[model samples]
Target chain A: MHYTEQSHTFRKIIMTKRITLADVAADAGVSAKTVSDVIHHRGRMREETRERVRNSMRALGYTTNLAARTLRTGSAKLIGLAIPNFAQPFNGNYADIVTSYAWAKGYRVSITTYHRLSQGLRELSADAYRFGVDGWIFLTDTPIPAQDNFLNQDRPVVLTGDYLSHGVADTIMFPNVEASQTATTRLFELGCERIGFIGAPANADSLDVTTQQLDAALTAQEGNSAMRLRGHLTALLQHNRSPLPSLVGACTRLDRSDGEKATLRLLDAGAQFDALFCANDAVALGAMSALTSRGLRIPEDVQIIGFDNTPDAAFSSPRLTTIDPFTEQYAQMAVDCLISRLEGDETAPTVHITDFALIERDSTRH
Target chain B: MHYTEQSHTFRKIIMTKRITLADVAADAGVSAKTVSDVIHHRGRMREETRERVRNSMRALGYTTNLAARTLRTGSAKLIGLAIPNFAQPFNGNYADIVTSYAWAKGYRVSITTYHRLSQGLRELSADAYRFGVDGWIFLTDTPIPAQDNFLNQDRPVVLTGDYLSHGVADTIMFPNVEASQTATTRLFELGCERIGFIGAPANADSLDVTTQQLDAALTAQEGNSAMRLRGHLTALLQHNRSPLPSLVGACTRLDRSDGEKATLRLLDAGAQFDALFCANDAVALGAMSALTSRGLRIPEDVQIIGFDNTPDAAFSSPRLTTIDPFTEQYAQMAVDCLISRLEGDETAPTVHITDFALIERDSTRH
Candidate 1:
């Protein structure tokens, strides 16, 4: 044999190509459709032939394209969700709950965080348009009125809580004001003489009108706010309690460090308050940590109440007595509403409100 | 006037619009271009005219579409990034670091999380394709294998540590095996005779390779791995050694309750162990909590070490000794690589490995 002929015969003998689906069908004396059906484990194949096909598929290396299958079904099975920030424990919990819920619904959630509330809302609206999210749930904190405009335009958007005003997007609102009022009232019912408030002043200024309303209803004081100082004094005087001095204001910052510093400032100022009501759990926890270091016994010397029943409340060394704002319920309801909107339910923006309950724990047992 | 005549007069009045830009220029005694410049806040406009134009805009409620302004400049000012399992603490930190970095660069990052690893990769790749992300940084638990044919097709992709195989996309990896070897060696230096190992089994298997290498380097009669019989033999041979056996097991199921139960089982089985080397901070914390509950003092009685120096590690009751895997560094590097690729850098895959350092805290110090 010539050299070229010898080389060609050697190449043919050495390179044994792997069997394809076509080869399997030809060898099995069946149509390519039958081979494909057997490969996919679709239907109606005899056991012996199924076994033969399965072995053949293994012998060959064939991978199915899931994307093609998904395209055929017209479902990408994905949902896009965004939140303001995840660094905060509460928002982290929110992201976690929404993700778990979305997963249970056979849809995957894509989560992104935005920092500035104004920017977050605009990005959310635009992202929903650019990214083909089945729907969107915005766990927002933007108090800007423009947030409403962007949300209204975003249509199929869900608002996690009363964090934003309604009539812009479908809203899931927690009874924040009601919860705060209830938390304040619980202290009074426990025979507390004087109560001081510690929270970020900036947050207090942006206080939702409903929260303002709840404060008004609870104390029977009507104005921009239910003056905690005035309420404490009125309660003291009306109940024939010992005459009290004006309430001392703690720093308005709501973070853990702020709470700690505020408590220290209150202590330093010689504020004769019997109970302390914190703006949120972080403030309460920080205050407790400070008080503990000062050798003060909680509920004996001072009763403390916190807002937002965070998961940390249960795990704290001395579990905190706080308000349960039902954020998860609000989130779930928001998802439901947004899904409806995405399904073409163009109902006028409606607000869903969930109630709050006071959870009495070791910290406030008088 | 009759109602129809009154309506016609009102419509005529409404149609009589305000002065146009030309009228503003003529009134202000400037060119139309100068008036337009003043209105748009162009740099060349005089400060006085700019103030006049600002006042006019406010009076007229002239709402500028910021999005349109960006389009005029051909910039969206947004980048879409995806990560797997943002709920995981490490991924959460990763997201925060990258978000801040992106913000510093004057770009907003739209984040999404995919729970299932491979599926997340596919969805993220698709998201990049459809959403027109300025760029993408794909953080995964595993490197994108070329054989993951769907992912190999195209798009700007960067892989982070966990899977460090060669011939893949631009990759960054943590030197986990190297770090584990160093951590293990440190334990030996600290006079820990019976070191128990616990972590995800696959991670433990990789550590086993490191331990084997260490044995060869040390040239000691002791084997890197301690089988039950081998542990018993070592204890029997060393006169002062406790009659306890070391264990290498899975950390996947190790939570607080599981730690308590597992410790009880090990204690009941009379397995003597002095030190535990955990896979992650969470497992280490659980193990430490169990040991202390059993009246065992850490380090003095049973030293503990963990991987992944998460924030909670330092704040842990008995601050866990953990390996700082440079997670932020890894995330930043991954972002840079993705940006470079987006900027049209076609360099071969560059592997960046971050060295791990042990943070000695309360748990590891007697």
Candidate 2:
């Protein structure tokens, strides 16, 4: 454990060649151990001796292999963080948090981004092996690659996002579907009828299983679209009451551009919706612009709700009502998962699904 | 280059023996060379033979020795992109670009962020050795680590933004001083002279040499507070010699928040400059917001110019007139410098500086 043989090599070379530690020790007239201790500065050496060793080391090109020593002990002092992309604000903050966290732990982190999902996941696994990282935390949107056919290097991998249906890896995910259901139920209780939904379509290409589950939960309460409408019409006929209007259609890709087009299309179709629910703040912002351009007042003409409580949401023209996806909580959870795995918590692949909160602002006051 | 001796002790016995090339070749009834060509998909292997080898490989569970091969060749296929932080929008895009570029080149990029300047440089040097990165491209705002004694590891280290001071390393920088001169000269040519500066203090803390150079360049032409005020006073010396107005003091930090605060303070101080030149677009935006809030029309009342033609500059309310800092071009040059070093071009360290372009937009076109 002491690596005394390598220390002998250091002693032999420094003894014969340029300025020997003995020469400095003779000048200072201290024991070689004292000089070595002073050179390493690891233990108690007189401050004066320490300064003299510091000057002696500098005077004689003494670059100790502390880094190499750490490496030889099978610990690279490195952690790996992988993300889908660094462009999105959410992922950007995620990258920042992981970097800060690793730095705080006295370990340096090396991050890698992959554009192609599968390749990203696979490459990260390969990197874990080649880099000999202490552990890996993957905040990715890609599916897990095949395991039996993996490169056969053993290392712990923690996946962020619970939509891990692959049944192969440990994961941490936010409760996306339950949160959406909660938001919808709250809107229904707010005496709002004829609510229109504007968001990206739930489809295979989207691959958002969490959102799809939310749609199912909502549909269960409202009944199938056509059947629900028919049932509402029947109830109305009996009570001489008007039927409630339902979501018209979901837009695919909920960016501002998508919101603008979707809003215009909804207005042109003469849908009498009193409230609009958007998938994210960017879409809601666009919808608000479109409605205001048409002289409709927020919560007066129509109410709007958005998801993803981004920082900008709080400061927009009319403060946006959104769901706090708790990106920080998610990031913390991912880190915890990775750390646990690295510590050998190999109890079957675990999943953590966090809850979401709805933050009400001026947009949804009605 | 051929590893014919496949009889390492570790390879001979294992708890669960892994399939190897010889097993796959034996299963396919072909030489290992034929299987190698099929696996690498190198030259021509008959479709029938390729399929036989592939099936045999699958049946035997053969895995490639890419790690061993990389170790043998000293090409780990990893590159390092060092940045100040990952969250800043500008540097975020830089990280993304380098990652995308490296991936396209069939190499992986590891990112290292240094929150503090010294710690970052130390980690970068250590990582260069530990991670087996072939080259390094450093885009930092602070000075390179003084203790970067990488004489032991002569891996390529190319820098951006004139960050390195005494270290003998390759660096790429933009013409910050010349660009500031150009921005000021262009304003001078615009005929309105009651100009005031609104930006971070002339001496920003922890700034690199290029920043100091830019400050010198701006001050060189009429270069002091009194001279600047005199230039502004001369502009108004034309009401038939118009009455001169006093120039304002420099604002520090040069961000949107600081810009707005400085603008409000200047307005409160009754500074009556006809034109305002800001440190950057963020400052210009903040100033524009303050002006709009005070009902002061742009160009009609106060023409403004800014530096750093960021993406949003072209889309600002009255599009911002700015200096195109060419961040992307900077990134490309840093990459070229790093690749050249990785490919063994350790020519004398030279400063690679590119020019900035003056982007005339709505803010400056009276």
Candidate 3:
């Protein structure tokens, strides 16, 4: 839809079957992607090869139809939702909710995944237009820096996650600090003395503290793990408790296996605790498996609290009690914010945090 | 890359920062999408809108730069991986494995999800081009009909799943029948007198069998559930055990919650079985949760086996016994097939199925 060429011979092709880019590529003795590269002048090739491809294009009349018809129909009212690969339960679960809300708001959602974390933010959604979206909603695990102009690279953008966007774009965040604090506080109220924590930016080998020590940690740090750990620490300090490094476990990722292995290592090291505050529900579920496998009972021998409150939390054995950060409402607000931006609301970009609640279940004492 | 326009006065644009589509949109008093539609000639709009957007484009000199620069560079060889959604363990888990293999083979992978089950095959692929995919590897749950041509719409396509493609495209299939049959037969060898099953197409409300009578069921059906069920039935018939309707639980989805509720329903209905053959790992995990919640010992009381030996299976309490469908190998084969097609293999599309094995864990007695 963004381009047009003048005065092409429209009648050079056969009508029996529609000619394709691959058909032209075969005739030119090149790949279809090569033919595409030539069509878009994407990468420079030898002039002779370009002529041969152009000749095949003319002979098949492919350019007049298939190649020229490559423009996406702009009528699709599309929104691009970008997620870092869907291995973790929260990423896919949140994406499903966002797609539903986006569709209900009369827009079709297309997904694009960012893989290989080492590629960094330059690779994070700097190419939304190529994937064909009028705007983008990037639910990222990476932290956005102050000058993160990738936020609004020509399209109205909404950034979600526990990262601080510095208002470079509209942001949606979970109450990583507040809710973790509250979850820890609740475990105390449930009659827990020593509490263990899982998930930090450290490896499973004895799990390093993000700061030199937990007491000196930045409560407003830039990661989900670090911030949540800070909140947990705050609650411990408030209760006049000395920090137990043995009770804190670290994970490389927030996946279930990560949780299970980390929990096993803690148990192997004899890191005893009456309660556990996990990073997310996936980790919590796996930790429960670890505890149960050892004949430990939930809410009696060791109480547990998880975050995110994913569908799995509700169905887990003992019905996992979790911190619900109002995911549905957060999804709705994000869509509305993006729609407002698309509708010419030039107001300064803002940060949005949804309300949180402790969803009590059988995993915790009443 | 398929479009170009010439001789526009680009000097009118501001030199300080790159002009964005939203900027032009704001100046033209239209949504960025509306400006996009006007630029693309996507659909019919009021003539007045067309004129106003053109005026804004001319005024801002946006046409000479940003709008004309929408072409994607063909340098990046890319593939599209389509799955139902990432919420399912198999979907996301399989996708991550495919992405790694695709990247190693020098292809960037993009994802697009198909939501709303009622949308069907017309929505299945038919529009891979609009999503800017060079080719697609569709891991679909929907069955493809005999005359399905969405396989190759100008671009090379590869379809993977239990569903038959009627040789419409290059296919990578799991040995659903053989592996499942083996899984059930092993339970009998392990001295299980009665076996329970979860995951049929029917709902949790007294799960319905596909055929009116189990004996008349089509051994060669089109779905993962039906085919796997047929394999189980073949094993039962081999052992001369009458199929117990109450022991057969049905699930609309193969998610964790669905498995939990279905297992509870079967147990509540007094369906006594010595073993349980679950459809997938997510289902198996949940079923285990249900049994454990009910105070039942794992292998001693009820031997359980699951499909898709996901990472979760290794860490699950009792360490779940599962059918190893060679997911990583399946991913490699699929990538190799697509690459061959891209490099112009020109051979007849072949059906490929990966080998399988029962990985004995604590959930099953060795």
Best by TM-score: 3
List residue ranges in candidate 2 displaced over 4 A: A1-74, A116-118, A130-132, A142-153, A165-167, A181-198, A201-276, A281-306, A311-321, A355-366, B1-69, B116-118, B145-153, B162-167, B175-324, B353-366
Q: How many residue pairs clash in each candidate?
A: 7, 12, 1
Runs off by more than 4 Å, candidate 3: A1-76, A147-149, A203-206, A210-212, B1-16, B19-76, B147-149, B203-206, B210-212
Candidate 3 per-residue C-alpha lDDT over A1-366 given as tens digits, one digit per residue, 9 for 90 to 100: 111122122222223466678888897888888898887767878888887887676544452333233442233356777778777777777777887888788876777667663443334344454565667787878676554344545567888877876666788888888999999999998889999998766744556553356665544566777788888988998998866778887888788877888888889988889999999898898899889888999889989999998876876767899999999888888888887877779899998889999999988998
Tens-place lDDT digits, model 2, residues B153-252: 4466776645543446776776655665566556667876666666633445531123333334333322222233233333333223333223444544
Q: What is the interface RMSD of candidate 1, in Å?
A: 13.2
Predictions in order: chain A TM-score: 0.67, 0.64, 0.78
lDDT of 1 at A143: 51
Best by lDDT: 3
**What TM-score, to 2 decimals, does candidate 2 have?**
0.67
Score candidate 2 by lDDT. 0.59
Candidates by TM-score, descending order: 3, 2, 1
lDDT of 2 at A54: 50
| Alpha-carbon TM-score of each model against the true structure | 0.63, 0.67, 0.79
DockQ list for all candidates: 0.11, 0.21, 0.16
Candidate 3 iRMSD in angstroms: 9.3
Worst 10 residues of 2 chain B by lDDT: B1-10
Per-residue lDDT for A1-366 in model 1, tens only?
Answer: 112212321221111243456876765667888887875558797877766654443223222222222223424455667766655446666766676776666666666676643345554554443343556687665453542354544335776634544366677766655566566667888878677666523335532122343333345322112233334334444556543222333344355666777777777767777788776777777777667667787878788887778655654435679888776776677667766776679768887888778899977874
Fnat per model, in the order given? 0.12, 0.21, 0.26
RMSD of 2: 9.7
Candidate 2 lDDT by residue in tens digits, A316-342? 445678778787777677676666666
Please report, as a residue range, the 10-residue window in candidate 3 chain A with the lowest summed lDDT. Answer: A1-10
